[model samples]
Target: MYQADIAIVGAGMVGLALARSLKEADLSVILIDTTPIAKPLSEQPELRVSAFNAANKQVLEQLGVWQHLDQQRLSAYTQMQVWDQDSFGRIQFSSEEMGTSELGHIIENQSLVNALHHQVSQQPNVQMLPSTRIAKVLAGQSETMLMLDSDEVVSCRLLVGADGANSAIRKYANFPLTFKDYGHTAIVATIKTAAPHGKVARQVFTPTGPLALLPLSDPNLCSIVWSQNSQQADELLALSNSDFAKALQVAIEGDVGEIGVESARMHFPLTMRYARQWLSDGLVIIGDAAHTIHPLAGQGANLGLQDAFALADSLQKLAAEQAAFHQARQLRAFERARKSEAVKMIAAMESFKQLFGGSHPLKKLIRGVGMCTADAIPVIKQRFITQAMGW
Candidate 1:
């Protein structure tokens, strides 16, 4: 059996980040994940990507991961353009209005993960366990023990479930969740274009769903996230690379001239899930394990990163007060501090998804009015920019 002061059930970004944060405070930490880490950031090719808001970048800097990332590979979007199809509705945002240098950075997902893992590896107080599956989880009076597939047991004062949407630890804790399937799938891939993205992230809303082009490190290369019904997504993915690129070029209104596919397309079901509770007697859930929001706004990873930061801060505060880390009161403080933000984000995404997906005449009217209103109100835009940057 392996014993530690804290055990994290997921070695993904959120888990690894929290582990690094905890170890910085001199706490013993163990990071376990079912899937083995593939490779280091510098050695891996681009597979998936994430947009890092300013706040998240600060967190990464604090964890020493940002310094490990190649500076040239980071893309900063300073502007955004959003519009709806078949309408004169459009909304635009500029970082200048927010008094910021840039809106956010677009980073390769694998590279970001590897950077965090590298930081964790360098931390002496943190133990890394990969390709290890949790077979059983038992919560004791003062500690929790996880039985692994390797027949080893891990005991710790606290347990964190960061294992993603279908979290086994969440199931073992009997956490309740509300789920809604949007009857849609999201297609993600890279696109090469003749025109530069100009540090702008654009999203076009259509009757089916949203089609977004987020700027990549290469000025001419952008990442596309197209949302649509299962049938349409199936057809799109089934098309040949050339045909798919042609169709996608039109879907995004061909704003970027001469678009072509640069990577294999991937599709994932669109869903919204929220756990009824975020904390239990001896366990805490973070990241996708606690909530799953619509990716339409590119805020999923940001929200998860916020969860990790909040928990890490809360625990640090308690430890500074010389309080026990595993106390229900201490854990509840973490939950209470984050629950409001989590619920607000989840609701906002759901509302946006529904408002954009509906076909009612009133809904169409509202969409147009909403964009115009947002554009007209400086306070609204400021608040929007603030929220988007996770401020």
Candidate 2:
């Protein structure tokens, strides 16, 4: 049997960050994950990437892992351009307006995971168990026990589920989930553009869905995320590399000039999910394990990171007062704070997805005009930028 103050299931960015945060507070932590730590990053960029906003950067900085990231793989975008393909209305947001050097950074997912893993290795108070699967979870009054596939039992004062959307801990703990399928698939790929990305992120709303060209570290390279209906996604996936590139060029209105596919395309279905309750006695959930929102806003990862920071902050504060490690009252407070914020963001993203995805003429006109109007209003635009910065 293994025991710790807290046992975190899932060693992804959120889980790792929480472990590092807790350990920094002199708490014992056990970090478990089914996937082995990824090998060191190579010159080639990984296909999976995420946009880290100001808040996320702050969390990483606090964890002392931000400096360890490969500088070559980090791309900071200072501007964002969003427009509707059906109308002439467009909106542009710049960091200059907000007195910030950059809005956010685009980084490969593997790079982040690697950095977190490296930091965890340096934390003597944190024990990492990789390639270990949790078979079952038993929640008790004073502690929770996780049964591993290897027939080992790990007990902890508190158990946190940072696992992805389909979280096993959430299931075993009986956290009810509300799920809604977006009926769309997001296709992701890396591409080389004829023109440099100019440190900007571009998103265009097509009749089918939204297509985003996120700036990459390489000025001439960009990461594309195209969300479309099932039929369109399948068709795009079936197209040859050159054909797909051509289609992509037409889709983005060739804003960055011609593009050539630089990597194999991959995709996954889109869904919005939320856990009805985020805490149960000594058990709690964070990150995708608690809620998942549409990728249209690209706030999913940021939200998860915020949850980790919030939870860690709460736990540290409580520990200072000599509170129980898994006091239900404190855990509930953390849940309330994070769940409310997550729900608000998820609702806003859902609204955006529905408004821009509609086919009605009035809605299309409203979408375009609303964007233009928001752009014309400095206060509104600044508010949008501030929100995106995770303020």
Candidate 3:
């Protein structure tokens, strides 16, 4: 039997970050996933990216994972602009108001995963099992056992599910989940604007949905997440790259100037997922396995990172106390805290979605008044910036 003190079922950014954060806990960690541990960094920028706030970045810096990242690939956005295409609702925020150098950094998702993988692999207490699958799991009152497809068994006191929104571990553990379709499909791709992005992130809400133009390392390059109803998304997806670019240019009303689709467009349906129980006897779930929210505000990844950090803290304390037998019960506080945060985030996203979704006259008026009110009040804008910064 192969065993470790803790076994993480997914080797993505969240799982690897958990393992890396436990380096000082003096406990063994084994990470498993069907995919390779470190995905190859492509010559061109990857289409998948995340807007990491200052809090998560500070934690990464503390873990030494930030240093492993290529500085050139990181885009520190100092400003943001949000407006509703159907109305005159517009709000702008700047890092200068918060006395910070950056509001956030838009990093390619794969790049951060590779950085975490690099950092975690070097820790003597951590082990990696890549290209492997768990054929079965048995969670007892005191321990969890993962049976691998290779006919190997892993016995650990605790098992963590970081697989993703459709987590197999969560399924195996029978963790109850609540999910809802957002009725939106997100189209993502790398894009080039006619003019420089000026290190600013911009989002525009249309009658269909919202479009986000996140600045990339290059001034002319950006990554876009365009969410719309499935029907409209399909219509747009059917268009050729050039035509799609033209459609995009018209969507944001040429906010970024002439848009050019620089990469193949890929899309996925948007859904919200929340696991009612984050932990059970000998088993637990975190990250996307626990909760997922809309991409409108770009807080999903940050929430996952927060989960990892919070759980790491709890587990470290448990290790220091030399807890055993009833260790699962000790994690209730951790689960409760993270779950509460997830609920709050989900509610916030839902409010934003409903408030800005359509062309209702009342909603449009509210959005316009709200944005103008926020922009005019320096204190209100500062509070918004602080909240977004996770400060």
Candidate 4:
């Protein structure tokens, strides 16, 4: 049987980041994932992407993984504009107004994953097993054993499931989950705009859903995330490239002048999920396994990175105390910290969705009044900036 201080299931962003953070602390870590990580240098640009909040970027920088990324391919958004279709009112937020340099950055998902994997490989205490599956997980009060598909077994003091929303590891633990299906689907892609993005991220709310244009490295390029009803999403995806672009134009109401298709569109159903328990015995769930929120705020990945940070901090504290690697107290602390943040984020997203998604006259009045109220309250604006930056 292989042995390590910790065993992580899933080598995606959250798992890799967690391994990198803990490996340098004199702890043995084994990261297992079914999909072999690909080399980022060989992939074409404008593929799957994610918005990295400021706090998450700091975490990557501290892990020394961010430095390995191609800076030229990133886009920093210094400003944002959010508006609704029912009214001609819009709210604009700028970094300058908040006394900051940037709100966040947009980067390709593969780039971030590749950089994290590269860093993990260099850590002496980290062993990465790619294209491997875990057949069984056995958790005890002080340790866990992971049975692999090949009949190989690995033992660790603690087990972490960085696996995504449909996490098998989480299921094994029987963590109760609260699930809400919005009956909406998000269509994502990249596009070329006739007008420059000007370092701004724009989100327009329509009756169907929210449409967002996030700035990319290229001035004329923008990342599109259009959330609509199931039927609307199906119709949009069924259209040809030209027709889809036309529909996108109408959705954003020509925010960036003429828009052209630059990447193939992909759609995914929307969901808001929260696991009642992130830890049981010697196992814990992080990232999407613990909580999955809507993409409206672009905080899903950022929150997952924060989970890694909190877990690493807890582990370091336990190590300093000379406690066992899988101390229940330490794991519990990690879960509490992460769950508190997740609860707040989940509530915020749900509130936003309900307030703007309704067609009632009172809701419209509240929407208009809320924008004005936000503009008038400088403190509220600053608070928003701080939250957006994950401060």
**Candidate whose lDDT is highest:** 3
Q: List TM-scores for all candidates, in order.
A: 0.95, 0.97, 0.98, 0.96
Per-prediction tally of clashes: 0, 0, 0, 0
Write down the TM-score for model 4: 0.96
lDDT of 3 by residue, 260-372 (tens): 88999999999999999988767889999999999999999999999999999988988898875226589999988999999999999999999988898998999999999
Q: By TM-score, highest first, what's the ranking?
A: 3, 2, 4, 1
| Pairs with backbone N, CA or C atoms under 3 Å apart (clashes), candidate 3 | none
lDDT of each: 0.85, 0.89, 0.91, 0.85
Between which residue pairs do clashes occur in model 1? Answer: none
Tens-digit lDDT track for model 4 on 1-391?
A: 8899889998988898888888657688999999897564534355567888888888788889999888888789999899887675578889899777898999888788888888889999988889999988777766788999989999998888999999999899889999999888999988999999999999988777888898988899998889888888899899999999888888788888888988778889999999998886678889999999988888888999889888988887777777775755557767787899999999999888878785677777778888878867889878887888888
lDDT per residue as tens, model 1, 269-324: 98888898878767889999999888888998998888998888888787788787
Give me the displacement of residue 208 in model 3, in angstroms.
0.7
Ranking by lDDT: 3, 2, 4, 1
Score residue 247 of candidate 1 by CA lDDT: 86
Model 3: lDDT to the true structure: 0.91
Candidate No. with top TM-score: 3
Clashing pairs in 2: none
Q: What is the alpha-carbon lDDT for the whole of candidate 1? A: 0.85
